[model samples]
Target: MKLTASAKLVYNFTGPTEVIGLIQASHSGDQTILSEELILSPDAALVEDEDVRGDRRFRTCLSTETSIVYTATVDNGMRSLLPRSGRQHLWNELPPEALAYLLPSRFCPSDSFQRFAQREFGSAGDGVSRVMSILEWIAAEVDYVAGVSTPESSAAHTFTVRAGVCRDFTHLGITFCRALSIPARAVSAYSLDVQPPDFHAVMEVYLENAWWLVDPTRLAPIEGIIRIAHGRDAADTAFLTTDKACTVVSQTVQVSRVDTAS
Candidate 1:
């Protein structure tokens, strides 16, 4: 499927603030960027970089006020796949790159949840089955409340409250997976089905020697999710980060399907 994603952000800064933005659709093997445009008001010099995972980040310095607009046309060729019922990889069998995700991170404290995870999902069978069980438990137990969580909220808080937004859901899922010795990471994306159209957060599990996208909130389909940035938690995948204090004046995000057939 083809998707058009866009975001507009306006911020008021007290002084010159260094900012990093990760609002562009990622270019990966499954997704092709056909066309893209980025507009920075006042046109400051920008530096762009891409991580090993294909997450793109743009850095700049802003004074007073700033407005950023970005648009992209992406051909997402990712297809939904059935869950693999394969055996879970042992610690020694895991790739060196997957080791980091298996450990606890800022928002996803896998170490703290190890006892709870084992008690709740220990008998769920293989890694994939346990992940499915985890998703089911989240869907049945958690409430999708937006304001219930703050930026500082973590998986432990969400587990206590039993409610949160997509970021919380993803964090909790990653926590559970990591607790069970599975490699999981948080993903930020532009999803076509997210209500109120915004930058969406999802979780990716390293299973069958590949990363598979999963949405515990069930707000968007995996196939409709366009990857932006991914990391251990929201701290790494935030769309905008400012070094100095700044107030958000306005922000809007939109993702829509584009029909290719005439």
Candidate 2:
């Protein structure tokens, strides 16, 4: 599938502030970046870096006010549908890198949810079955209320309130997966179907020696998700981070499907 994604951000910085932005689609084996453009108002110098996990980061300094615009067209060739069944690796069998996702993080306190996860999903079997069960439970139990959660909300908080947006949903899913000893991480992406057209949050789980994308909110199809960045939790995948306090003046995001021949 071909997808076109874009974002516009306007901010006011009270003082000199360092900013890191992660709003670009990832360059990976499964996706081909056919065309892209990034514009910074007032033409400030920018530094680009790619992390070990392939997440691209753009660093720049802002004073007074600034605006950022990024747009990209990509051909995502990877399969969107996950397999019905896959073997769940025991902790001892997981690869070294996958081990990190099986632990707790700032927003995904997997350590605190072990007993709850086991009691709720212990009989869900393993691998994809367990993952599907978790998604179903979240869908059935949680309410997708937008203003009910804040940046500091964690999986435990969401579990307590049974309400949150995509970020909270992903955090809760990751926490539950890790609590069950399945490696899972948070994913930030652009999806064609997200209401209000904003950056979307999802989860990726390690199964059958690979990471599979899962959207607990079920707002967007997996095939239409264009991954931007992924990490232990929302703390790592945030679109914008500033060294000093900054006010968001305005922001907009849009994603749509493009004709393959176009």
Candidate 3:
């Protein structure tokens, strides 16, 4: 499916501030890009780099207040297929690139949840079934409350509170998957047709030699999701990161589907 997406962030600076942002769509095997427009007011020198884990990063130093506007139009053909039963990847057969996701991370402490995961999902039929069970449990147990979780909130906190936004749900899912020895990572994306449209967060679990997308919030269709960044947790995939002091004056994100048959 084809979609158009944009994000605008207005910042007020008391002094010079350096910023690093990861808000551009990732050019992956499944998504085809048609066009993209990015602008920084009072333009400064911008540098782009890809991290070791394949996350794209953009950096700029701002001496004056500015607005960051990013717009993109792309076709997303990556749709979630029906979960395959009895499909699982053993530890010895897994690829080296997927090893990091199986370990604990900043927001997702998979090591601490081993007992809980095994007790709750150990009897599941297969890896995919356990992941489905985890998704269902989170969807039913967690309350989707906005502004309740802070940037420092971790999977353990969300698990205890049993309430959080999409990011929390994703972290919990990733944590559970990793605790059970399944590789999982957090995914940032522009989700078309999601209510209260905004930049959305979901997750992907590696199973049967492929990463499969899963939305714990179940708020958006899998086909309408366009990935921007992939990371172990929210810390690595944040839309904006800064080394200097700055206050957010205003922020807005918009996403919509465009009909081509007009």
Candidate 4:
């Protein structure tokens, strides 16, 4: 199966920003279940337009702007895809073993987070039932409201307070997975179904033999869904950043999932 997606974020900064830098992971990652024969572009020139990833790493410098746009297209294999229950676990990075090392930035999976996960999820190791329980509780706890929370919110904060947007939910969920020793990371990108000029977040849990997308914000698992990029946290995949302060006044985005030939 082939999936193509587009994402754009419009920023209305209160003040001018200098040297806008963007770190995007919108490229579709290659997985045992899904082979990324062609990812549009990992990085590209900054414009009020579309972007994609090529085979290699892409980088660019953006002029100070309030809004940023990102995008991706992925060729996914339909068969050989693993079920949620069969996702692989990292025994080597189990909490006991990983606690000593902090997980590298969102780019490299961390050992510290794994150790934290191991300690919490050891009881329910390799059990989809257990993982589902954790996800459900989180969805129920977190409030899906944009502009209400910032990236600073921690996993423990969202879990204990239960009030945040998709980013916070994803952060909390991914952190919990790490705390339990399951390889997990936060996904920041765009969702077609939702209004664009906006951002979305999800959790990618390394389970069974592959990574699966879980949207705690929507309280559902996203399989065969389009992905823009991924990283340790929202900071890693921020679409827009400014040197000075700014306030967004208005923004708009449109996204859709299109099917292509195999």
Candidate 5:
């Protein structure tokens, strides 16, 4: 299977922003079932991107303008990849000293999440299964609703509200994985082939010494996917940035997966 997607971002700011940054998390990577063949992030002065090993990585671009425009595209090759042992070779660099500090306060580094790990997956179990189980549980238990929250939304909110979009879902997944010492991070990217290029979010966990991506916000639980940008959290990766003094007039996005039959 091959997957591709595109996103056009438009920004509006009243006055020049002292500084503005945009995160285009619109690239998918090679997976057990998918391989990224090509990824193109628009270099239109306002968008600079980099290649990463995981599902979503950021191309941070800074601007001092009132408005900015940019686009991103990703091509993925689908393959059926799965978990294997001895994969955590790269993660050997992960320091225990950094584990506790990796997650911030909003991530809910609480005993509730920690204890849940003990009761459900046990703290010592494999990281992939632990993260996967948490994602499945979140997707099944939480209902979906639009305009309910933003990327700054908390994991505790998702568990309580039982409804939110991709940002909320990924937040819950990230917090849970990190709380359990799995070294999960939040990914903010675009979902192409989606009716209005919607912001897609996911959580990538450190396992087998490397990062394995998971999309808790999979609009559809099927395969054939494209990914974009990723970061520690939404704060580190947002598709749009407004100037300090500008007012947004309107915004829209259109994303679609190519239907070869069409």
Candidate 6:
């Protein structure tokens, strides 16, 4: 499928602010970019870099009393097959590099949820089955309410509240999967045709030596996801971060399918 995605971010800064933005479609085997551009108003010099985790970042400093607007648009081709249920890797079978996901992170405190996960999903037959069960459980239990969760919310908190947005759902899913010793991580992406269009969050689990995309929100087709970044949690994958005080003036995201190959 061919997709065009765009995001517009407007901010008002009080002083010189150093900012890092991660709002571009990732260049990877799963997706190929046809065209893309990012425009910054009151344009400042930007230093672009790709981090070790494959997140593309543009760093720039804004002048005092600045009103900044950043817009990005991209046309890309995405290839993602909805995965079938199958055998998954054992802890001992996973590569050493994949072990990091098992450890607790800020938003996904896997260690804290281990007992609950085992009690809740221990009867599941295999890793893939267990992960599916986790996703189903979250969907059945949580309310997808916006504003119910704050930026500081974590898997434990979301579990207690039984409600949150896409990121919270993704966090809880990752927490449960990791609690069961399945290596799962957070993924940020542009979701084609999601209602109330916004940047979306999902989770990827390593199974059979490969990562499979899963969405607890079930908002868009996994095939429609245009990945932007991957990390342990939202903190590492946030689209915008600034060192100085700034208030968001407006934000908008759009995504649409331009074409599809049958």
As for candidate 2, its clashing pairs are none
Candidate 1 regions off by >4 Å? 82-84
lDDT of 2 by residue, 1-262 (tens): 8899999999999888999999998886667889999999967899999977777999999887888999999888765576899889988899999999999999999999899999998788868898999999999999999999999999999999999999999999999999999999999999988998999999899999888999999999888988899999999999999999999999999999997573
- As a whole number from 0 to 100, the lDDT of residue 53 in candidate 3 is 46
For candidate 6, give the lDDT: 0.83
lDDT of 3 at 241: 90
Q: lDDT for every model?
A: 0.90, 0.92, 0.88, 0.52, 0.54, 0.83
lDDT of 3 by residue, 25-69 (tens): 888777877999889887878999876645577998887779999
TM-score of 5: 0.70
Candidate ordering by TM-score (highest first):
2, 1, 3, 6, 5, 4
lDDT of 4 by residue, 70-182 (tens): 44454544523335465434586444423322254442333445655565555663546456756777756567666666557666566556787777777777666655555
Best by lDDT: 2
Show where candidate 6 strays beyond 4 Å: 64-78, 260-262
Quote the lDDT for 139 in model 3.
84
User: What tens-digit string does per-residue lDDT give for candidate 6 at 65-169?
Assistant: 444333334443445543556566777888887898888999999999899999999788777778878988998999999999999999899999999999999
Q: What is the lDDT of residue 193 in candidate 3?
A: 72
When 2 and 3 are scored with TM-score, the better candidate is: 2
Residue-pair clash count for candidate 3: 0
- Residues 166-235 of candidate 1: C-alpha lDDT, one tens digit per residue: 9999999999999999999999999988998888999888887777888989999777878898888999
The global Cα lDDT (0 to 1) of model 1 is 0.90
Error in Å for residue 240 of model 2: 0.7
* Candidate 3 Cα lDDT to native: 0.88
